[model samples]
Target: MTPEEILPDDLMERIRGRAAGYDQDNSFFHEDLAELAAAGYLKVFVPVPDGGLGLGLEAAAALQRRLATAAPATALAVNMHLVWTGVAHVLAARGDDSLGFVLKEAGQGEVFAFGISEAGNDSMLFDSGTTATPEGDGSYSFTGRKIFTSLSLGWTRLGIFGKDAAARNGDGELVFGFIGRETPGHETLTDWNTLGMRASQSNTTLLQGAVVPPERIFRKLPVGPNQDPLVFAIFACFETLLAAVYTGIGERAFTLALEAAKHRTSAKYGGRSYAQDPDIRWKIAEAAMAMDGIQPQLASVARDVDALVDHGPQWFPKLVGLKVRATENARAVVDIAVRVSGGSSYFRGSELERLYRDVLAGIFHPSNEESAHSTVANAWLGPLEM
Candidate 1:
């Protein structure tokens, strides 16, 4: 079946309904992903000949949003596969055939680790002294530890970003090769401790000069301070997906706050109802408004990103602008959740408290603040030939 037929309509609704219960019970999410693999949802972006949906970023963004709203941790788990599947799909459809097998494997229930981070200094986006250089015998050895890798349990492949440091920096080039998580020299060190995205199962990956055959490597693509259209689309999708999940988390938090407010009574004014006070009422309205405010911007950004890919890559800077807004809105969603939940929301397992911790994950990504600064500076200084 085509990607359009990959998931039944009932399954989508089922995943949505599954979200409400995931926090309370994780059975469905932990297994549903494997189920998604069985059904080929994981490889939808890959084309038919390669055994995938051949879907574009627009559809991928929607799927990302849907899974994210269902279970934040589950969404985090799938992000690894989506990224691998995406680049691999492009490679396959564009005529590189080897990567197609990995996509097929992914569709058949195999998973890859996003082993980008490292232990000493944070390096998820950039390679932190990791190197993939050639051995005299026609193979390259991957060395160095990667920290905070997600869905580390039972993974089969890894999308690692490393540089052939022997070359100059920037031109040093970053490569994300697909490697077996259990490759002989590879080691996994557990120590997942996080305040949010709890149960994400993040851990450290140590490749002790693990040797990867040249055949295991997908050709490295060019990336820079200013990325190409495909890279920008991935970044846009990442930001948009994060925004939607935070919105979902906030929605749950707001509901908790509203329910608490409705039943809460205060004796400060001699048995006055807390929910009856104008100040308290304003918080509820504000939280609802913030939640409502995010939807249009989300839809707009998704549409613009979709339109750009089909036309040309010239307009990525515009999509980045929308992504920046979504990133800021994500932070706002958390603030609204906190405001409406009030003090008592701190109780453990409180959806507000959980979501508050969850939202923090959004900002942990590359500094959008820095990205914005450079963009504005470049635009003001005016553009020219690269």
Candidate 2:
């Protein structure tokens, strides 16, 4: 199905209307989540036979971009669930059914969340700060903290990873597994208050011996980077979907700027429309040009992933590049929108004001500016000559 069909204009308007309220109240998008779930939005990656939309990654990215145009925080939070399901879909399409359960559970209406982020583990997917102690029965107990756990209140299954320090004869292994919300050892702190994206409520999670049975354990890769399809799938889905959200933000900002330029009259220019002002026209054109370049990149990368295009070592660079470009461009567009929309946008309840703050969060996601640059550099220049 098309993005418009998945998220109708009326539904988007309702979501847009709730965004400011959720931000002001510093609350989760409970209503939005319920509405989206009821609309079968959370299962966009699940197969048709499993009762989902059965759309590809490109389509899923489009849907997310559409969702973000209405509510960025909600879209950001929902991205966590979609990431896991998307990863499952990616892996399954590659003949790996290891995460097939994710699809099944999601199709059954269970919410899956991405829980791999840590406080200071910059190694990202390559390494883990969390400890995964192996059990006698092949299960594992995870003990560590996972920060920025989005959908904290709504996730039924959280996909997390940690290092089993004792595995591989002390070489260590990164253990990936899923823990249910009913698990007794994890706690979600209500400390998500932030400068923006407040509705995401992405609080920190403390895992105090959260155990996953062998059945839930999916991958056990050696410490540090490797050529695992699971890694590719996670990075591909996370980065592309993330880019889609920010691209949507940029699209919305550009639209708002266009409207402002057309309607706002300039007193200094004899009450003429700002659109007639040369500077305002220039800013609008700048935003439009910036936004125009991102959709094609987002579309191409997402389509490649869905089609299983093999970029080899260049894949990481492509994924990270798309994320960095989309996010940075979106921030620039929001900034321009704020500048063109006049001082009223500075008000707390103004959507442009909120977007300005929300867009700043793009710098904090994985494959950040520094990381993206490093990845691309290494991909081109080869790893630093030690």
Candidate 3:
């Protein structure tokens, strides 16, 4: 189904109307979450037979882009849950049923959140600062701090991983598992104030000996990176969905700029609309041109993932490259939009102003500018010399 069918214009408008209040209060999108859950948006990746829409990555990305236009924070926070379900689908399609339960739980309305990021842990998925201790019953107890845990207020299940320092005969192993919200030894900190994307309320989570039963324990890979399907699935889904949200931000900003240009008149030109001004038109054209290039790239990458096109070694570069381009392009588009939008965008509560702040968050997500460049460089130039 089309994005419009899933999120009607009226529903989008209501969500757009509340974006400002949520940002201003620095609160979570509780009402938006409820509405989205009732709409079955939370189950977009689960198979139709399992009570979900059974959408592919391309379709899910489209829906997320559309949703971000209305409420970026809401879209971003919700992306966490979609990532897990999307990962499950991707893995299962590749003949790996280890994470099949994730899909089943999602179909039953379970909310999943990612818990991979950490403080000063630049290794990302390759390694972890968290400690994982085997409980001798096939279970593991994780003790570490996870930051930027979006959906912090609402996640029923959190996917986390840590290092089993004693495993692999002193080499080490990374244990992956899922823990419930009601699980003891975990705390969600109430510290989410930020420069932008405030409504996401992506607070820090302290996992103090949180345990995941054997049934929930999934993969246990070597210490460093390897050709693992789970690794590829997580990176693919996470990067693609994230790029979609930022692309939506740019799309909305461009629309608002166009609207502002057509309506606002310049007294210096005898009340002529800014749309007639050469410079204003040029700026709008630049924003449009930049936005035009992103949609196709985003669509192509997501579609390739869904189709299982074997990019092989180039997949990481493509995934990280798309993320960087979409994010940087969106940020640039928002800046141009603000310039063409005049002084009103400078004031608080204006959609453009909120977007200006929201778009800045693109720089902070994983596959960040530096890391993205490094990944692409490595893909083409090989690793750095000693």
Candidate 4:
């Protein structure tokens, strides 16, 4: 495709049209995102050798920012693949043979979801109620329920984690298994709903005696008694993408508020333009300022991500700092977006309402304020490495 056809001019317009009814219609745009996947957006950063376009981080970041402005949830859901898949691809490129098949499958639009969060683990992943005990035949019986397994039934494979069953000295490791969701014992319950990003279809997947073959394991055992630094580094990048989506939600809210206020007629004391209301205009201006103030930092973090490819493992802590600072920035932008939109914005069909809900997704990501801060500070001054 030529430059004119490169981005598909109708993409943004299409997303905008879907934005109004995204929660109630389009059936989650299950088909449209498939087109995006076919167009290579889904495999944007996977290397060409792995049957991908290898558009690189800079291009991916640009696309990330652009897509967030139109359909934030598409961007949100895509991040699940984009952030982790890309990092996993990078690790695969380094000759991690275990991930080769997974990366190749992803390049062909194969879908996998990260299943990290769970119920009653007390917030610690390793101690989750779920367990995968080895059955002595190179397969394991994974037993437990996982809550908030976003993209539950729709996923082709789920990156399930459990305590490594083969620990000799009692220091166990996290074993990531890419279990097929269609397995007989694996079932999904889409009974849960959220205040925002309803299209995320984030639901619970029940695993009762779900047998996982050893071939399904993605990251297994340790790297010769050492852990991979890429895990934490990749996590930092996901948080940044979340921050980017939050930033875009605020921008959309600001745009909608400006357009609405300019046309709204003041009802009190002889009709005047709502734009003429001194207080309303002032609030809009403040939101605009907040939007302007936050974006430069976002841009800087994008640049730092590019720098990561060259800086290597040392960039882990820096990327964590970026996520820590920017998630707060995104939360700030969403707050201002809601404040400027006012009470009417709370209406079920309002754009601000969806944007507000979508932005909240960032605050709940694994690398929220507290987690990111702790990681960054530990990397900086800890006596024992975390």
RMSD of each: 5.0, 0.7, 0.7, 3.9
How does model 2 fare in lDDT?
Answer: 0.94
Which is the winner by TM-score between candidate 2 and candidate 4? 2
Per-residue lDDT tens digits for candidate 1, residues 1-386, read: 43235556666566545543554543326656666777777776666665667675556655665555445666666776676666555545445565666767776667776777665543334444678776866567788888767777747888676667555554765555667756778887666666667556667888888877767766454334434333543455555555555555555566667777777777775676668867778887887787677766666666655454353443444444545554566566556656655677777666666666766776665435556555555665765458
- Which scores greater on TM-score, model 3 or model 4? 3
**C-alpha lDDT values of all predictions:** 0.62, 0.94, 0.94, 0.66
lDDT of 3 by residue, 120-237 (tens): 8888998999999999999999999999999999899999999999999999999999999899989999999998899898999999999999998999999888999999999999
Score residue 32 of candidate 2 by CA lDDT.
98
User: Can you give the TM-score per candidate against the true fold?
Assistant: 0.76, 0.99, 0.99, 0.83
Error of 1 at 12 (Å): 9.4
Query: Which residue segments of model 4 deviate by more than 4 Å?
Result: 1-7, 25-27, 49-51, 92-97, 122-127, 221-227, 265-282, 309-317, 380-386
Error of 2 at 184 (Å): 0.9
Candidate 2 lDDT, 1-386, residue by residue in tens? 78898899999999999999999999999999999999999999999999998988999999999999999999999999999999999999999999999999999999988889998899999999999999899999999999999999899999999999888999999999999999889999999999999999999999999999999999999998899999999999999999999999999998899888888998989998899999988888888888889999999999999888999899999999999999999999999999999999999789899999999999999999999999999999999987
Off-target runs (Cα >4 Å) in candidate 1 are: 1-29, 35-40, 48-54, 89-99, 118-128, 136-138, 167-173, 221-230, 261-277, 308-324, 379-386
Model 3: lDDT to the true structure: 0.94
Error of 2 at 144 (Å): 0.4
TM for candidate 3 is: 0.99
